[model samples]
Target: MSYVGRFAPSPSGPLHFGSLVAALGSYFQAKSQHGKWLVRMEDLDPPREMPGASDLILATLEAYHLHWDDEVIYQSQRHHYYQDQIEQWIASKEAYYCQCTRRQIKQSGGFYLGTCRDAALTPEQPCSVRFKVPTAIDHFIDQKHGRIAIPKALADEDFIIKRRDGLYAYNLAVVLDDIEQGVTEVVRGADLIEPTGRQINLYHAMKQPEVSYLHLPLALDEHGNKLSKQNHAPALNNEEPIETLLSAMTFLGFDIDAHITSANLDEIIAWGCQNWSLQQLPNSLASTARF
Candidate 1:
């Protein structure tokens, strides 16, 4: 299959420097391999979404000259598809409804203790649906991090797929979307490393084709906190696309010494793609000024 990669960003806030790093990394990786790069709007969580954040993100990408192949996909428009997958899992007994409240789980530590696995409740009880995690260790080799073994404790934790409030969980939606979009490889931040195991289990349960994963180092703030909307990270400067793009290139481990004088975003990205190398990425996350 032709290499397919994506940059799926939530529209909860504007695109920050951290978000740009991820987008640029994935974009160059795909372009360098002569593959297709697509963008997907992960707007499933309505409660956290900003009013016009989706449009703003698209505008920001355009301003940066990071164009995507084909039309962008919005997750909110695929609710029925996710619901159908959930129903199939239920019919196959691979998923169960849980009536356990947040207080119960909090009291017993963070992981859900499978209290509702054998509960005598109907689907109409307003219960959240959870995937019955498998016992065997799910292992996958990270393109950058080498072989990874997910702990049994985490692997066995019965995680949620559909929330009690009727929102589709991120893990479920992401897995389904990747399979549907035929994503052969995933390029994302290391913050999502833990969730990769759960998603891999889901892929196995569904018997779907496995996709390779590369978790890039996260950009941090001077205080050591991950730069994010919650941390008040400033949005990308759409007006100064070259400066922002060059900064993102450096974050991805590119040497832009000669091309630092590049006049435009296109020239920078073109040169960056021509010289993109996964081996050049730093193994550890680093802090940068909050621009």
Candidate 2:
């Protein structure tokens, strides 16, 4: 398959430094290989989404010179797509209804213990649908982090596909859209490494081709906390686009020489496409103290 990648961001807030780092990492990886880079707005949860956040995200990407190949995808508009696949899974017994809450799962040793697996209960208004994780995926190959082992016991637990509020779950939505977009690789932050296994199982259960993974270092604040919207990460200031882009490039372990660093936006990005290497960076997560 021809190389293809994406930078899907939730429209919960404006783009931040961490989001920029992830976007640059994915963009560089795809462009370096002459692949198509797409953008998607994961805006399913209306309660968490901010008004005008999606447009802001697109505008921010444009301002940063991270151009995408095709029209942007919004998750809210694809509810039918997610719902159709979920219904098919339920009919085929690949997934089932789940009524367990977070507190109940936490009481059951952190990970879900499949309490409602055999309930055969009718789907309710406030219930979630859990995917029946097949035992097919034992491990996933991360391009930068190497092989990540998954225990068979963990796969036996049912993971949610739709939430109690009727919103689609990230794992399910992501895998389906990735398949739909033909995403060949997923270059993201190390914070999402833990969900890779479950998503791998989604690929197998959904019978979609698995995409390659390349998790970049998590961008951290001075306090060592991962910078994120929920963590109150400040939005990226488009006023200093060049400085922000250069800093993000350097954070990704690129050797931005003085020539490239001082070049115009388009030139600097062109240089990045020619020289970016996902394999060159250390696999471990690092902090961006200056952020």
Candidate 3:
């Protein structure tokens, strides 16, 4: 299969430095291998989305010269497809309706303990759909982190695919989207590593081909917290793309020249692609920075 990678960003806010790092890493990896890189808007959760964030995100990518190959996809527009799959899973016994509340799961040691597996609750009642996890250890090799095995306890817990509020869950939407888009590899930040196993299991359940994964190091703030929109991380400086791009490249462990006279954004990005090295990345989860 041809190499297909993607940068799917939720339109919760504008792109921050951390967002740029992930986008740049994904873009460089796709270009380095002469593969197609696509972008997708994860705008499923309307309550959490900010007005005009989707357009702003695309504009930011263009300003940074992070061009995607194909037309961008939006999750909010694909609800019927997700709902159809949910119906199929319910009919095929691959999933069950879950009515357990968050407090109930928390009381059961934080991880869901299949409390509603045998409930046989009808969809008429308020309920979420959960994939019935098979009892097997889920493991995958990260391109950067080496072999990783999800704990048996976590691998066996039935996870939600749809929420009670008539919304699809992230795990379900993301895996389905990747499969549909023919994504060959997932290159994103390490903050999403925890969900890899669950997503792998989804592939197994659906009998779809699983994609390779490469999680980049997460950028942190002065307070040691991961730089995020929720943390109020400042948006990227669109006026100074070169400086910001260079700083992002440095955070990814690239040895940038101290001074580049008249170097444009395209040239800097090309330099990054030519020098991209997965082995040079920091193995640590967090990097503290003032930028």
Candidate 4:
């Protein structure tokens, strides 16, 4: 089968240094393999989404020469698809509505203890649908981190699939979108490593094919926290696209000489795709580029 990769960025805010690293890493990986690369806007959570953030993100990607194939997909337009999958899961008895509050779970070791797994409650009382997690999940391999096993203590939590407000949860939306889009590989930051296992389990429950996962190291601020919209990280400057791309490439373990700084975006991308290697990436979480 032909390889298909994607960079699905949430439109909560503009692309920051961390988002740039993820985009460039996935872009080069696909380009190097001569595979198709696509982009998707994960704008499902309206409350967290910033106005015009999606358009600004696309413009930034274009400015950095990270063009995608086919029409970009928006999650907001695909609500029906997620609903269909949820209905199927419900029919199969693989999911159940839970009325457990945050305080209840917090008092029970921070993981949902299946408090409402068998509760016969109507949807009128504002309940979230949760997946019935299995007792044990087998180990799955990470391209960068190697074979990894998620302990039952962490994997046994009954996780939510649909929020109380009826919005599709991230795990459900992402898994369904990947299956629909034919994504063969997922490349993103290490912050999502644990979620990958959960998604893998969901894929198995849904009888969908498993996709390879590669989680790149996260970019951290001076305070040692990951750069993210929640942390108030500054957005990328569209005026200096090349500078941002080059900085991102360097963060991904690419060795670009000072002379290469004069190269255009296309030329830099060409070199990057040709020279991209997973082994060059640092395993340490502290790996970052100096701004």
Alpha-carbon lDDT, every model:
0.87, 0.86, 0.90, 0.86
Instruction: Please write out the lDDT profile of model 2 over residues 1-291, one tens digit for every residue.
Output: 799999999999999999998999999899989899999999888999999999999999999889999889998999999999998988998889988889988888888887888899786546899988767466778897788766666656677889988888998889889999999999988888767888888887767778899888888888889899999998998777998888888888887788986799999999988988867676677666454
Off by over 4 Å in 3: 258-262
Better of 1 and 3 by lDDT: 3
Cα TM-score per model:
0.96, 0.95, 0.97, 0.96
Estimate, for each residue in 183-283, the C-alpha lDDT of model 4 and write its tens digit: 99999888887777788888888788889988899999888889999999899988988887888888889899777899988889999999999998887
Clashing pairs in 2: none
Give the Cα RMSD of candidate 3. Answer: 1.3
Superposed model 2: Cα runs more than 4 Å off: 136-138, 150-154
Runs off by more than 4 Å, candidate 4: none
Query: How far off is residue 117 in model 4, in Å?
Result: 1.6
Question: Candidate 1, which ten residues in sequence have the lowest lDDT sum?
Answer: 282-291
- lDDT digits (tens) for residues 153-266 of candidate 3: 788899999999988999999999999999999999989988899998889888998899999989998878999999999999777888888888888988887554258888
> What does candidate 4 score in Cα RMSD to the true structure?
1.3
Span of 10 residues, lowest total lDDT, candidate 3: 254-263
TM-score of decoy 4: 0.96
Worst 10 residues of 4 by lDDT: 282-291
**Candidate with the larger TM-score of 1 and 2:** 1
